[model samples]
Target: MSNSQQQYPFYFKSTIILFGISLVCYALFVLSDILAPIAFSLVIAILLNPMVTKLQKRGVNKIVAISLAIGLAFLIVAGIIYFITNQIVNFGDNLPQLKLKFNENLANVQQWLNTHLNITIAKQQKLANEALNSSQALLGRTVGGALGILSLIFLIPIYVFLLLYYKTLIINFFHEVFAEENSAKVSEVLGATKAAIQSYMVGLLLEALVVAVLNSVALMIIGLDYAILIGVIGALLNMLPYIGGIIAIALPVILASVTKDGYSTQLAVVISYIVIQFVDNNFLVPFLVSSRVKINAFFSVLVVLLGGALWGISGMFLSIPFVAILKIIFDRLPEMKPWGKLLGDEVPTRHKGEIWQRKRLRQEASNPEKEKSL
Candidate 1:
């Protein structure tokens, strides 16, 4: 048998293995609707671990700490729900005015199109009517869909509470299952995983808060109606990464174009969103998240899109950290290190020559008597 023939079989096996892994990942994506809530709960549990630890240090029992953390989380969630509900109610009361303003803007757009092109007013009106009809159906579906989503929201806190309470038991079980020699390595990996998830969650929350406050204040200063609602939406969407900034800007611009008296206000809203995103990406995330999850831009975009495909908006929001965790595990395995390297931003430096040179120098530096003794 030739050497090349032997190598061909190895390459073919490796290809098969990769294909199998991809198939499994695709299946997981299809099932992500069921898994997303569980994933979200795990992320929350990691985020709250520090608080749980502090509470335990203060002599509180594990169950009590977990319960208290869950209670606080529920209260925070309730407050947000209360605020959003009030906003929706106020917006509902002003819907007629909003619709009128929207129609006025639509007229302006139609006028611009007529002036710029050879389109007839009748054709434009027909198009507008069709669009309005479609929008009504879409809005009805969206409202109905939201009720179903609200039902699922209750599951998150319960999942989080159970995860927190069982976290130690889970870790201990894993440690016991693994050989004693491998247990330390397993623990180290788990520790790193927890730290990465915690840092990501906290950093993201801080970024959202900063974006929300700055955006709301900027819009309020510009005298935009429903500035609070727009700001909150912007902050929430900003958690999704690259595409989120654009979505955040569009919402406010649409709102301004419809409700504001002038085009200048619409431009101002756009500029404010851009500035907030700039501050967030450049200044906020880097400092808050540290150098823990160093994913490259290409993979970042790919994972976010893949996540969006799998689980829609929630998947997109979770993709980066999810990929980061996978990368961490890949790096620890010898065969998967190359895949991990691909996911990382920085090119790892080759240390073979450096190590050889260092060893040579050390040998040269050693005394003759020491060398002879060795």
Candidate 2:
């Protein structure tokens, strides 16, 4: 009967609602393998929507515009695959020489260890042999694997096409679902979400191009083998945020150690990667992606890890935009604005009046001598 007892019931109900939502999210993540292609398709649809709109405005039929957009996307994907396959084949052709270089480098490392450390040559050789055996097993399982390749060959394009075709319907459905009361708020959130995603994809693509070119040039200048392959792979991986940088760095260093015949070359490769990552993090990412997502470093890393765990690499690649979409939704909801603040980089200040007053006073303080001069 008491007010406090009534409040307790409300709090308990809210907790139950939150718990249900969390459970739903967990289930979705567990089913992510099936969902990943669909998620990627949605992302592609958002990216292509502007082009579709532009074509429509130019007197193209809606269906025709959608078809043209999808065709262009397919061509882009095909071209990338062709280029990557060619680079891979070229690398494969040079494998024999690369293997010889690797053995020579291993022998040199063993000799260096024998001279400097107290470990015996026989013990080092045993360890090397064990490592080789483990690596062979791994390659047999990974390269001989059929599941991943089949998914890429069959599933991806099918999903992408369906997504493009249904894009308008999906958007309209969401708009209608939320238009019961605050249609304007729903529209604003949807618009912001689309803009954020589009901006992110565009910026990320440009960043990758820049990184690929820089990495290729650096590796070529250093006279390392498979520089193009390393550069291109590095750039693509770099699209995944935090974890991608390390992978990009490691690939070059590993390849250099195995192909170039010296620790000095390996060291150089490492240094080059560090420099590239430095430029990318400090300059490229901030300039390109920071404004669009507007989430802080902590949430970025958290979402990426969660995404990786949920959908593997595909999830990681899509996580930021996913979170950005969620943030937009949360920001528009009165009770969920706190959740949005938690997801965002800048905490929304409730004391805006005080903040502005302080800023104005600081400006006045800086110009006191000017005021006196006037």
TM-score of 1: 0.79
In candidate 1 the C-alpha lDDT for residue 232 amounts to 90
- For residues 213-244, what per-residue lDDT tens digits would candidate 1 score against the true structure? 99899999989988898899888888777877
TM-score of each: 0.79, 0.77
Which run of 10 residues does model 1 get worst, by summed lDDT? 139-148
Candidate 2 weakest ten by summed lDDT: 138-147
- Residue pairs with backbone atoms closer than 3 Å in model 2 (clashes): none
Give Cα distance to truth, residue 61, candidate 2, Å: 2.4
At residue 23, what lDDT does model 1 achieve? 95
Off by over 4 Å in 1: 1-11, 107-151, 347-374
